[model samples]
Target: MLYSEKVMEHFTNPRNVGEIPDADGVGEVGNAKCGDIMKMYLKIDNGIVTDCKFKTFGCGAAIATSSAATEMIKGQPIETVMKLTNKAVIDSLDGLPAQKLHCSVLAEQAVKAALSDYYTKNGIDPAPILGEIGECAHCAQ
Candidate 1:
Protein backbone atom coordinates (compact mmCIF):
# COMPACT_ATOMS: atom_id res chain seq x y z
CA MET A 1 0.00 0.00 0.00
CA LEU A 2 1.18 3.53 -0.65
CA TYR A 3 0.19 4.58 2.84
CA SER A 4 0.62 2.99 6.22
CA GLU A 5 -2.27 1.63 8.26
CA LYS A 6 -2.18 4.56 10.65
CA VAL A 7 -2.25 6.98 7.78
CA MET A 8 -5.46 5.48 6.50
CA GLU A 9 -6.99 5.58 9.93
CA HIS A 10 -6.35 9.26 10.47
CA PHE A 11 -7.42 10.16 7.00
CA THR A 12 -10.64 8.27 7.40
CA ASN A 13 -11.31 9.70 10.84
CA PRO A 14 -9.47 12.96 11.11
CA ARG A 15 -9.49 14.82 14.36
CA ASN A 16 -9.98 18.56 14.79
CA VAL A 17 -11.13 18.99 11.22
CA GLY A 18 -12.72 22.46 11.59
CA GLU A 19 -11.54 25.84 12.83
CA ILE A 20 -11.45 28.13 15.79
CA PRO A 21 -12.41 31.54 14.45
CA ASP A 22 -11.03 33.22 17.55
CA ALA A 23 -7.81 31.33 17.35
CA ASP A 24 -4.85 33.12 18.85
CA GLY A 25 -2.70 31.99 15.97
CA VAL A 26 -3.48 30.62 12.54
CA GLY A 27 -1.37 29.41 9.65
CA GLU A 28 -2.14 28.46 6.09
CA VAL A 29 0.50 26.69 4.03
CA GLY A 30 0.34 25.45 0.47
CA ASN A 31 2.20 22.40 -0.76
CA ALA A 32 4.25 23.01 -3.81
CA LYS A 33 4.68 19.31 -4.39
CA CYS A 34 1.03 18.67 -5.16
CA GLY A 35 -0.52 22.10 -4.96
CA ASP A 36 -2.44 21.13 -1.85
CA ILE A 37 -3.09 23.44 1.10
CA MET A 38 -3.23 23.02 4.85
CA LYS A 39 -4.49 25.56 7.34
CA MET A 40 -3.95 25.23 11.09
CA TYR A 41 -5.61 27.10 13.91
CA LEU A 42 -4.43 27.27 17.50
CA LYS A 43 -5.92 28.64 20.68
CA ILE A 44 -3.40 29.38 23.40
CA ASP A 45 -4.14 30.11 27.00
CA ASN A 46 -1.46 30.65 29.66
CA GLY A 47 1.20 29.54 27.19
CA ILE A 48 -0.54 26.27 26.59
CA VAL A 49 -2.12 25.10 23.36
CA THR A 50 -5.57 24.61 24.75
CA ASP A 51 -6.97 23.71 21.38
CA CYS A 52 -5.99 23.15 17.75
CA LYS A 53 -7.76 22.38 14.47
CA PHE A 54 -6.79 21.86 10.87
CA LYS A 55 -8.28 21.98 7.39
CA THR A 56 -6.36 20.25 4.67
CA PHE A 57 -7.13 20.19 0.96
CA GLY A 58 -4.77 17.50 -0.18
CA CYS A 59 -4.23 13.82 -0.60
CA GLY A 60 -4.82 11.11 1.95
CA ALA A 61 -1.29 11.55 3.26
CA ALA A 62 -1.71 15.23 3.87
CA ILE A 63 -5.01 14.82 5.64
CA ALA A 64 -3.66 11.98 7.77
CA THR A 65 -0.52 13.86 8.71
CA SER A 66 -2.47 16.96 9.61
CA SER A 67 -4.84 14.94 11.74
CA ALA A 68 -2.02 13.19 13.57
CA ALA A 69 -0.16 16.47 14.00
CA THR A 70 -3.10 18.25 15.59
CA GLU A 71 -3.63 15.32 17.93
CA MET A 72 0.04 15.47 18.91
CA ILE A 73 0.12 19.19 19.64
CA LYS A 74 -3.25 19.92 21.15
CA GLY A 75 -3.15 20.65 24.87
CA GLN A 76 0.65 20.65 24.85
CA PRO A 77 2.65 23.66 25.97
CA ILE A 78 3.91 25.99 23.28
CA GLU A 79 7.49 25.09 24.07
CA THR A 80 6.78 21.45 23.52
CA VAL A 81 4.66 22.04 20.49
CA MET A 82 7.40 24.13 18.91
CA LYS A 83 9.77 21.22 19.31
CA LEU A 84 7.60 18.88 17.28
CA THR A 85 9.35 17.46 14.25
CA ASN A 86 8.22 15.90 11.01
CA LYS A 87 10.09 12.78 11.94
CA ALA A 88 7.92 12.44 14.99
CA VAL A 89 4.76 12.80 12.94
CA ILE A 90 5.99 10.30 10.42
CA ASP A 91 6.98 7.90 13.15
CA SER A 92 3.66 8.35 14.87
CA LEU A 93 1.92 7.45 11.64
CA ASP A 94 4.04 4.28 11.57
CA GLY A 95 5.68 5.29 8.32
CA LEU A 96 4.87 6.87 5.01
CA PRO A 97 5.98 6.25 1.46
CA ALA A 98 9.09 8.17 0.43
CA GLN A 99 7.16 10.52 -1.82
CA LYS A 100 4.68 11.21 0.95
CA LEU A 101 7.43 12.34 3.32
CA HIS A 102 6.75 15.90 2.30
CA CYS A 103 3.35 15.58 3.92
CA SER A 104 4.90 15.29 7.35
CA VAL A 105 7.05 18.32 6.69
CA LEU A 106 3.87 20.24 6.02
CA ALA A 107 2.46 19.12 9.37
CA GLU A 108 5.47 20.35 11.31
CA GLN A 109 5.79 23.56 9.35
CA ALA A 110 2.12 24.38 9.70
CA VAL A 111 2.29 24.00 13.46
CA LYS A 112 5.38 26.15 13.83
CA ALA A 113 3.99 28.66 11.44
CA ALA A 114 0.90 28.95 13.60
CA LEU A 115 2.99 29.26 16.75
CA SER A 116 5.19 31.85 15.14
CA ASP A 117 2.09 33.73 14.15
CA TYR A 118 0.92 33.57 17.73
CA TYR A 119 4.17 35.05 18.94
CA THR A 120 4.24 37.74 16.29
CA LYS A 121 0.63 38.66 16.89
CA ASN A 122 1.39 39.02 20.58
CA GLY A 123 4.17 41.57 19.92
CA ILE A 124 6.90 39.08 20.77
CA ASP A 125 9.44 38.19 18.11
CA PRO A 126 9.27 34.48 17.26
CA ALA A 127 12.79 34.21 15.91
CA PRO A 128 14.33 33.95 19.37
CA ILE A 129 11.85 31.35 20.47
CA LEU A 130 10.68 29.29 17.50
CA GLY A 131 13.61 30.13 15.27
CA GLU A 132 13.24 30.04 11.49
CA ILE A 133 10.29 28.06 10.15
CA GLY A 134 12.59 26.56 7.53
CA GLU A 135 12.02 26.46 3.80
CA CYS A 136 10.21 23.34 2.63
CA ALA A 137 9.93 21.93 -0.84
CA HIS A 138 6.35 21.15 0.06
CA CYS A 139 5.54 24.63 1.29
CA ALA A 140 4.70 27.46 -1.01
CA GLN A 141 6.73 30.65 -1.44
Candidate 2:
Protein backbone atom coordinates (compact mmCIF):
# COMPACT_ATOMS: atom_id res chain seq x y z
CA MET A 1 0.00 0.00 0.00
CA LEU A 2 1.16 3.55 -0.76
CA TYR A 3 1.55 5.76 2.27
CA SER A 4 2.07 9.51 2.38
CA GLU A 5 5.44 10.88 3.34
CA LYS A 6 3.95 12.62 6.34
CA VAL A 7 2.37 9.41 7.55
CA MET A 8 5.61 7.56 7.13
CA GLU A 9 7.48 10.22 9.06
CA HIS A 10 5.13 10.17 12.02
CA PHE A 11 4.83 6.42 12.00
CA THR A 12 8.58 6.00 12.09
CA ASN A 13 9.04 8.55 14.84
CA PRO A 14 5.75 8.86 16.62
CA ARG A 15 5.53 11.51 19.28
CA ASN A 16 3.30 11.22 22.34
CA VAL A 17 3.50 7.46 22.04
CA GLY A 18 3.14 6.77 25.75
CA GLU A 19 0.78 7.13 28.67
CA ILE A 20 0.35 9.53 31.56
CA PRO A 21 0.79 7.71 34.88
CA ASP A 22 -1.69 9.87 36.73
CA ALA A 23 -3.91 10.96 33.93
CA ASP A 24 -6.96 13.03 34.76
CA GLY A 25 -8.89 10.82 32.40
CA VAL A 26 -8.23 7.92 30.09
CA GLY A 27 -9.95 6.64 26.95
CA GLU A 28 -9.39 3.22 25.48
CA VAL A 29 -10.74 2.17 22.10
CA GLY A 30 -10.50 -0.22 19.18
CA ASN A 31 -10.42 -3.99 18.86
CA ALA A 32 -7.52 -6.34 18.32
CA LYS A 33 -9.35 -8.06 15.49
CA CYS A 34 -9.17 -4.92 13.38
CA GLY A 35 -5.37 -5.02 13.55
CA ASP A 36 -5.48 -1.73 15.46
CA ILE A 37 -6.08 -0.48 18.95
CA MET A 38 -5.49 2.80 20.78
CA LYS A 39 -5.42 4.00 24.35
CA MET A 40 -5.31 7.74 25.02
CA TYR A 41 -4.44 9.67 28.13
CA LEU A 42 -5.16 13.29 28.97
CA LYS A 43 -4.50 15.82 31.68
CA ILE A 44 -7.21 18.44 31.84
CA ASP A 45 -6.95 21.46 34.06
CA ASN A 46 -9.57 24.17 34.35
CA GLY A 47 -11.48 22.90 31.37
CA ILE A 48 -8.41 22.87 29.12
CA VAL A 49 -6.48 19.87 27.90
CA THR A 50 -3.07 20.52 29.37
CA ASP A 51 -1.47 17.45 27.84
CA CYS A 52 -2.37 14.44 25.71
CA LYS A 53 -0.68 11.18 24.85
CA PHE A 54 -1.48 7.85 23.30
CA LYS A 55 -0.37 4.27 22.74
CA THR A 56 -1.37 2.68 19.46
CA PHE A 57 -0.85 -0.78 18.02
CA GLY A 58 -1.73 -0.74 14.37
CA CYS A 59 -0.52 0.31 10.95
CA GLY A 60 1.30 3.49 9.99
CA ALA A 61 -1.96 5.30 9.46
CA ALA A 62 -3.09 4.51 12.98
CA ILE A 63 0.08 5.76 14.61
CA ALA A 64 0.13 8.97 12.61
CA THR A 65 -3.50 9.63 13.30
CA SER A 66 -3.06 9.13 17.05
CA SER A 67 -0.01 11.36 17.20
CA ALA A 68 -1.75 14.07 15.22
CA ALA A 69 -4.77 13.92 17.47
CA THR A 70 -2.65 14.39 20.56
CA GLU A 71 -0.85 17.36 19.05
CA MET A 72 -4.18 18.90 18.02
CA ILE A 73 -5.68 18.84 21.50
CA LYS A 74 -2.79 20.02 23.64
CA GLY A 75 -3.46 23.36 25.34
CA GLN A 76 -6.93 23.49 23.79
CA PRO A 77 -10.08 23.55 25.82
CA ILE A 78 -11.60 20.15 26.33
CA GLU A 79 -14.85 21.39 24.86
CA THR A 80 -13.02 22.54 21.77
CA VAL A 81 -11.17 19.28 21.42
CA MET A 82 -14.40 17.43 21.79
CA LYS A 83 -15.52 19.04 18.56
CA LEU A 84 -12.72 17.37 16.64
CA THR A 85 -13.67 15.01 13.84
CA ASN A 86 -12.01 12.47 11.60
CA LYS A 87 -12.08 14.96 8.74
CA ALA A 88 -10.14 17.47 10.82
CA VAL A 89 -7.53 14.87 11.74
CA ILE A 90 -7.18 13.75 8.13
CA ASP A 91 -7.00 17.36 6.98
CA SER A 92 -4.28 18.04 9.51
CA LEU A 93 -2.26 15.26 7.95
CA ASP A 94 -3.01 16.55 4.41
CA GLY A 95 -5.03 13.38 3.79
CA LEU A 96 -5.24 9.62 4.06
CA PRO A 97 -6.40 7.00 1.59
CA ALA A 98 -9.98 5.80 1.67
CA GLN A 99 -9.03 2.41 3.13
CA LYS A 100 -7.14 4.12 5.96
CA LEU A 101 -9.92 6.58 6.71
CA HIS A 102 -11.07 4.53 9.66
CA CYS A 103 -7.71 5.03 11.27
CA SER A 104 -8.42 8.72 11.48
CA VAL A 105 -11.89 7.96 12.74
CA LEU A 106 -10.38 5.78 15.46
CA ALA A 107 -8.09 8.61 16.50
CA GLU A 108 -11.00 11.05 16.68
CA GLN A 109 -13.05 8.55 18.63
CA ALA A 110 -10.19 7.91 21.05
CA VAL A 111 -9.83 11.62 21.80
CA LYS A 112 -13.51 12.06 22.47
CA ALA A 113 -13.57 8.89 24.51
CA ALA A 114 -10.72 10.25 26.59
CA LEU A 115 -12.58 13.53 27.03
CA SER A 116 -15.64 11.61 28.08
CA ASP A 117 -13.63 9.90 30.76
CA TYR A 118 -12.28 13.28 31.84
CA TYR A 119 -15.77 14.67 32.16
CA THR A 120 -16.91 11.65 34.09
CA LYS A 121 -14.02 11.99 36.49
CA ASN A 122 -14.98 15.63 37.06
CA GLY A 123 -18.50 14.48 37.90
CA ILE A 124 -20.02 15.68 34.66
CA ASP A 125 -21.47 13.76 31.76
CA PRO A 126 -19.98 14.15 28.37
CA ALA A 127 -22.28 14.62 25.42
CA PRO A 128 -24.52 11.78 24.43
CA ILE A 129 -23.17 9.00 22.21
CA LEU A 130 -22.52 10.49 18.77
CA GLY A 131 -23.53 7.44 16.79
CA GLU A 132 -26.69 6.90 18.76
CA ILE A 133 -27.98 10.30 17.73
CA GLY A 134 -29.35 9.50 14.28
CA GLU A 135 -25.97 8.70 12.78
CA CYS A 136 -25.66 5.75 10.43
CA ALA A 137 -25.26 2.37 12.06
CA HIS A 138 -22.18 1.60 10.04
CA CYS A 139 -20.34 4.66 11.33
CA ALA A 140 -21.65 4.07 14.82
CA GLN A 141 -19.82 0.81 15.00
Candidate 3:
Protein backbone atom coordinates (compact mmCIF):
# COMPACT_ATOMS: atom_id res chain seq x y z
CA MET A 1 0.00 0.00 0.00
CA LEU A 2 1.34 3.39 -0.99
CA TYR A 3 0.92 5.95 1.75
CA SER A 4 0.89 9.66 0.97
CA GLU A 5 3.99 11.71 1.56
CA LYS A 6 2.03 13.89 3.94
CA VAL A 7 1.03 10.90 6.00
CA MET A 8 4.62 9.80 6.26
CA GLU A 9 5.70 13.28 7.22
CA HIS A 10 3.26 13.57 10.09
CA PHE A 11 3.87 10.02 11.21
CA THR A 12 7.62 10.50 11.27
CA ASN A 13 7.53 13.74 13.20
CA PRO A 14 4.17 14.12 14.83
CA ARG A 15 3.39 17.35 16.56
CA ASN A 16 1.85 17.62 20.04
CA VAL A 17 2.90 14.03 20.58
CA GLY A 18 2.83 13.77 24.36
CA GLU A 19 0.67 13.83 27.41
CA ILE A 20 -0.51 16.92 29.25
CA PRO A 21 0.31 16.40 32.90
CA ASP A 22 -2.64 17.40 35.09
CA ALA A 23 -4.69 17.71 31.95
CA ASP A 24 -8.22 18.98 32.29
CA GLY A 25 -9.39 15.94 30.33
CA VAL A 26 -7.75 12.82 29.04
CA GLY A 27 -9.23 10.41 26.51
CA GLU A 28 -7.90 6.92 26.12
CA VAL A 29 -9.18 5.05 23.09
CA GLY A 30 -8.71 1.72 21.31
CA ASN A 31 -7.28 -1.28 23.10
CA ALA A 32 -4.37 -3.58 22.37
CA LYS A 33 -6.84 -6.01 20.82
CA CYS A 34 -7.76 -3.35 18.28
CA GLY A 35 -4.15 -3.03 17.13
CA ASP A 36 -4.26 0.69 17.81
CA ILE A 37 -4.29 2.63 21.05
CA MET A 38 -4.61 6.41 21.17
CA LYS A 39 -4.79 8.70 24.18
CA MET A 40 -5.61 12.36 23.85
CA TYR A 41 -4.99 15.05 26.45
CA LEU A 42 -6.81 18.33 26.46
CA LYS A 43 -6.60 21.60 28.32
CA ILE A 44 -9.90 23.41 28.12
CA ASP A 45 -10.74 26.82 29.50
CA ASN A 46 -13.96 28.76 29.24
CA GLY A 47 -15.36 26.54 26.49
CA ILE A 48 -12.25 26.71 24.37
CA VAL A 49 -9.90 23.83 23.79
CA THR A 50 -6.75 25.66 24.71
CA ASP A 51 -4.42 22.80 23.92
CA CYS A 52 -4.55 19.33 22.44
CA LYS A 53 -2.05 16.51 22.41
CA PHE A 54 -2.01 12.79 21.79
CA LYS A 55 0.04 9.66 22.16
CA THR A 56 -0.70 6.86 19.71
CA PHE A 57 0.61 3.37 19.17
CA GLY A 58 -0.46 2.02 15.81
CA CYS A 59 0.19 2.20 12.11
CA GLY A 60 1.40 5.25 10.23
CA ALA A 61 -2.16 6.14 9.41
CA ALA A 62 -3.14 5.99 13.06
CA ILE A 63 -0.29 8.23 14.10
CA ALA A 64 -1.07 10.72 11.36
CA THR A 65 -4.74 10.69 12.22
CA SER A 66 -4.00 11.38 15.88
CA SER A 67 -1.59 14.14 14.95
CA ALA A 68 -4.03 15.76 12.58
CA ALA A 69 -6.91 15.49 14.99
CA THR A 70 -4.96 17.22 17.75
CA GLU A 71 -3.89 19.97 15.39
CA MET A 72 -7.49 20.38 14.24
CA ILE A 73 -8.89 20.77 17.74
CA LYS A 74 -6.32 23.10 19.27
CA GLY A 75 -7.69 26.56 19.95
CA GLN A 76 -11.12 25.58 18.61
CA PRO A 77 -14.24 25.74 20.75
CA ILE A 78 -14.83 22.55 22.66
CA GLU A 79 -18.25 22.19 21.03
CA THR A 80 -16.71 22.56 17.59
CA VAL A 81 -14.05 20.01 18.37
CA MET A 82 -16.71 17.62 19.55
CA LYS A 83 -18.41 18.02 16.20
CA LEU A 84 -15.33 16.92 14.28
CA THR A 85 -15.96 13.65 12.52
CA ASN A 86 -13.83 10.81 11.29
CA LYS A 87 -14.74 11.81 7.75
CA ALA A 88 -13.45 15.32 8.34
CA VAL A 89 -10.18 14.06 9.80
CA ILE A 90 -9.75 11.66 6.88
CA ASP A 91 -10.58 14.39 4.40
CA SER A 92 -8.10 16.73 6.07
CA LEU A 93 -5.43 14.23 5.19
CA ASP A 94 -6.48 14.24 1.53
CA GLY A 95 -7.96 10.82 2.32
CA LEU A 96 -6.94 7.60 3.92
CA PRO A 97 -7.13 4.22 2.22
CA ALA A 98 -10.17 2.09 3.03
CA GLN A 99 -8.36 -0.14 5.48
CA LYS A 100 -6.94 2.83 7.35
CA LEU A 101 -10.24 4.65 7.74
CA HIS A 102 -10.77 3.13 11.16
CA CYS A 103 -7.73 4.99 12.41
CA SER A 104 -9.52 8.25 11.74
CA VAL A 105 -12.53 6.97 13.62
CA LEU A 106 -10.35 6.24 16.62
CA ALA A 107 -8.97 9.74 16.47
CA GLU A 108 -12.43 11.29 16.25
CA GLN A 109 -13.72 9.15 19.09
CA ALA A 110 -10.75 10.05 21.24
CA VAL A 111 -11.53 13.72 20.89
CA LYS A 112 -15.14 13.21 21.90
CA ALA A 113 -14.04 11.07 24.79
CA ALA A 114 -11.73 13.83 25.96
CA LEU A 115 -14.46 16.44 25.70
CA SER A 116 -16.80 14.17 27.60
CA ASP A 117 -14.25 13.94 30.37
CA TYR A 118 -14.07 17.70 30.50
CA TYR A 119 -17.82 18.15 30.80
CA THR A 120 -18.12 15.44 33.39
CA LYS A 121 -15.33 16.81 35.55
CA ASN A 122 -16.92 20.25 35.54
CA GLY A 123 -20.38 18.84 36.32
CA ILE A 124 -21.66 20.22 33.04
CA ASP A 125 -23.65 17.78 30.95
CA PRO A 126 -22.16 17.02 27.63
CA ALA A 127 -24.03 18.21 24.59
CA PRO A 128 -26.94 16.00 23.54
CA ILE A 129 -25.16 15.28 20.32
CA LEU A 130 -22.53 13.37 22.32
CA GLY A 131 -25.23 10.71 22.86
CA GLU A 132 -25.11 10.79 26.67
CA ILE A 133 -24.22 7.20 27.34
CA GLY A 134 -24.52 5.70 30.81
CA GLU A 135 -21.92 7.17 33.11
CA CYS A 136 -18.76 5.26 33.82
CA ALA A 137 -15.76 6.29 35.93
CA HIS A 138 -14.86 8.49 33.00
CA CYS A 139 -18.20 10.14 32.57
CA ALA A 140 -20.90 10.88 35.17
CA GLN A 141 -21.35 7.62 37.02
Candidate 4:
Protein backbone atom coordinates (compact mmCIF):
# COMPACT_ATOMS: atom_id res chain seq x y z
CA MET A 1 0.00 0.00 0.00
CA LEU A 2 1.12 3.51 -0.72
CA TYR A 3 1.56 5.99 2.10
CA SER A 4 1.65 9.77 1.94
CA GLU A 5 4.93 11.60 2.37
CA LYS A 6 3.76 12.83 5.77
CA VAL A 7 2.95 9.31 6.85
CA MET A 8 6.34 8.02 5.81
CA GLU A 9 8.02 10.93 7.52
CA HIS A 10 6.27 10.18 10.78
CA PHE A 11 6.90 6.47 10.49
CA THR A 12 10.58 7.07 9.92
CA ASN A 13 10.86 9.54 12.79
CA PRO A 14 7.95 9.45 15.20
CA ARG A 15 7.41 12.38 17.52
CA ASN A 16 6.69 12.45 21.21
CA VAL A 17 7.63 8.82 21.58
CA GLY A 18 7.94 7.30 25.08
CA GLU A 19 6.20 7.72 28.43
CA ILE A 20 5.92 10.67 30.74
CA PRO A 21 7.23 9.76 34.16
CA ASP A 22 4.53 11.85 35.82
CA ALA A 23 1.71 11.79 33.33
CA ASP A 24 -1.56 13.14 34.59
CA GLY A 25 -3.36 10.54 32.51
CA VAL A 26 -2.61 7.47 30.44
CA GLY A 27 -4.57 5.30 28.02
CA GLU A 28 -4.09 2.13 26.03
CA VAL A 29 -6.08 0.54 23.23
CA GLY A 30 -5.60 -2.36 20.89
CA ASN A 31 -7.13 -4.29 18.06
CA ALA A 32 -6.82 -7.97 18.81
CA LYS A 33 -7.38 -9.02 15.23
CA CYS A 34 -4.71 -6.67 13.92
CA GLY A 35 -2.35 -7.18 16.85
CA ASP A 36 -1.89 -3.43 17.09
CA ILE A 37 -1.59 -1.79 20.49
CA MET A 38 -1.23 1.89 21.37
CA LYS A 39 -0.57 3.68 24.62
CA MET A 40 -0.88 7.44 25.09
CA TYR A 41 0.38 9.70 27.85
CA LEU A 42 -0.69 13.23 28.71
CA LYS A 43 0.51 15.96 31.00
CA ILE A 44 -2.20 18.54 31.62
CA ASP A 45 -1.64 21.69 33.57
CA ASN A 46 -4.11 24.55 34.00
CA GLY A 47 -6.47 22.95 31.49
CA ILE A 48 -3.84 22.87 28.76
CA VAL A 49 -2.10 19.84 27.39
CA THR A 50 1.41 20.65 28.43
CA ASP A 51 2.75 17.54 26.78
CA CYS A 52 1.68 14.39 24.95
CA LYS A 53 3.42 11.15 24.09
CA PHE A 54 2.65 7.70 22.77
CA LYS A 55 4.00 4.19 22.29
CA THR A 56 2.61 2.08 19.46
CA PHE A 57 3.20 -1.48 18.41
CA GLY A 58 1.72 -2.10 15.01
CA CYS A 59 2.20 -1.30 11.36
CA GLY A 60 3.73 1.86 9.97
CA ALA A 61 0.29 3.43 9.69
CA ALA A 62 -0.38 2.94 13.40
CA ILE A 63 2.93 4.48 14.38
CA ALA A 64 2.45 7.43 12.02
CA THR A 65 -1.05 8.11 13.25
CA SER A 66 0.11 7.99 16.87
CA SER A 67 2.95 10.36 16.13
CA ALA A 68 0.73 12.83 14.27
CA ALA A 69 -1.93 12.69 16.93
CA THR A 70 0.53 13.55 19.68
CA GLU A 71 1.91 16.46 17.70
CA MET A 72 -1.61 17.75 17.10
CA ILE A 73 -2.48 18.10 20.78
CA LYS A 74 0.80 18.82 22.52
CA GLY A 75 0.28 22.49 23.28
CA GLN A 76 -3.47 22.79 22.86
CA PRO A 77 -6.14 23.28 25.44
CA ILE A 78 -7.84 20.17 26.75
CA GLU A 79 -11.17 21.22 25.26
CA THR A 80 -9.60 21.70 21.85
CA VAL A 81 -7.87 18.35 21.98
CA MET A 82 -11.15 16.73 22.97
CA LYS A 83 -12.49 17.80 19.59
CA LEU A 84 -9.70 15.95 17.76
CA THR A 85 -11.03 13.36 15.34
CA ASN A 86 -9.61 10.60 13.21
CA LYS A 87 -10.37 12.61 10.11
CA ALA A 88 -8.16 15.38 11.41
CA VAL A 89 -5.37 12.92 12.04
CA ILE A 90 -5.76 11.47 8.57
CA ASP A 91 -5.80 14.91 7.05
CA SER A 92 -2.67 15.82 8.94
CA LEU A 93 -0.96 12.79 7.46
CA ASP A 94 -2.31 13.77 4.01
CA GLY A 95 -4.19 10.46 4.19
CA LEU A 96 -3.89 6.76 4.85
CA PRO A 97 -4.75 3.69 2.85
CA ALA A 98 -8.42 2.74 3.09
CA GLN A 99 -7.55 -0.54 4.79
CA LYS A 100 -5.32 1.27 7.27
CA LEU A 101 -7.88 3.96 8.12
CA HIS A 102 -8.61 2.14 11.34
CA CYS A 103 -5.22 3.23 12.57
CA SER A 104 -6.43 6.82 12.59
CA VAL A 105 -9.50 5.79 14.54
CA LEU A 106 -7.29 4.20 17.13
CA ALA A 107 -5.35 7.44 17.42
CA GLU A 108 -8.50 9.41 18.13
CA GLN A 109 -9.74 6.84 20.62
CA ALA A 110 -6.42 6.78 22.42
CA VAL A 111 -6.60 10.53 23.02
CA LYS A 112 -10.13 10.28 24.34
CA ALA A 113 -9.14 7.37 26.53
CA ALA A 114 -6.35 9.43 28.05
CA LEU A 115 -8.72 12.34 28.61
CA SER A 116 -11.14 9.97 30.26
CA ASP A 117 -8.41 8.84 32.60
CA TYR A 118 -7.63 12.44 33.42
CA TYR A 119 -11.24 13.20 34.21
CA THR A 120 -11.62 10.08 36.32
CA LYS A 121 -8.47 10.88 38.28
CA ASN A 122 -9.84 14.34 38.96
CA GLY A 123 -13.04 12.77 40.35
CA ILE A 124 -15.05 13.70 37.27
CA ASP A 125 -17.42 11.36 35.49
CA PRO A 126 -15.82 10.14 32.27
CA ALA A 127 -18.67 7.89 31.22
CA PRO A 128 -20.96 10.80 30.46
CA ILE A 129 -18.27 12.34 28.29
CA LEU A 130 -16.04 9.62 26.90
CA GLY A 131 -18.67 6.90 26.86
CA GLU A 132 -16.79 3.56 26.82
CA ILE A 133 -13.14 3.05 25.97
CA GLY A 134 -13.15 -0.29 24.19
CA GLU A 135 -11.12 -2.25 21.72
CA CYS A 136 -11.15 -1.17 18.09
CA ALA A 137 -14.14 -2.88 16.54
CA HIS A 138 -13.11 -1.95 13.00
CA CYS A 139 -10.54 -4.69 12.63
CA ALA A 140 -12.50 -7.14 14.73
CA GLN A 141 -15.15 -7.62 12.14
lDDT of 2 by residue, 1-141 (tens): 777887888888888888899999898777777778889999988988998889998888999999989988999986688888889988888899888988898898888778778777878766663232122123446
Task: Give candidate 1's error at residue 133 in angstroms.
Answer: 1.0
Looking at model 4, residue 105 earns an lDDT score of 90
Model 1 spans with C-alpha error above 4 angstroms: 31-33, 138-141
Candidate 3, residues 1-141, lDDT tens digits: the string is 877877888888898999899899998887766678889999988989899889998889999999999999999997798789889988888888888877888888889888888878989787665874222222221
Pairs that collide, model 1: none
Ten contiguous residues with the weakest lDDT in model 4: 132-141
Residue pairs in clash, model 2: none
Instruction: Give each model a TM-score.
Output: 0.94, 0.89, 0.89, 0.94
RMSD of each: 1.7, 2.7, 4.8, 1.3
lDDT of 1 by residue, 76-141 (tens): 999899999999999999999998888889889899999989999999999999888876774544
Each prediction's total of clashing residue pairs, residues at least 3 apart in sequence or on different chains, is 0, 0, 0, 0
For candidate 3, what's the RMSD? 4.8
Task: Quantify all predictions' global Cα lDDT against the true fold.
Answer: 0.91, 0.82, 0.84, 0.92
On a 0 to 1 TM-score scale, where does candidate 4 land against the true structure?
Answer: 0.94
Clashing pairs in 4: none
The digit string of per-residue lDDT tens for model 4 on 1-141 reads: 899999999999999999998999998888545768889999999999999999999999999999999999999998899889999999999989999988999999999999999999999998987777665667657
**Model 4 CA deviation exceeding 4 Å by range:** 132-134
TM-score, candidate 2, is: 0.89
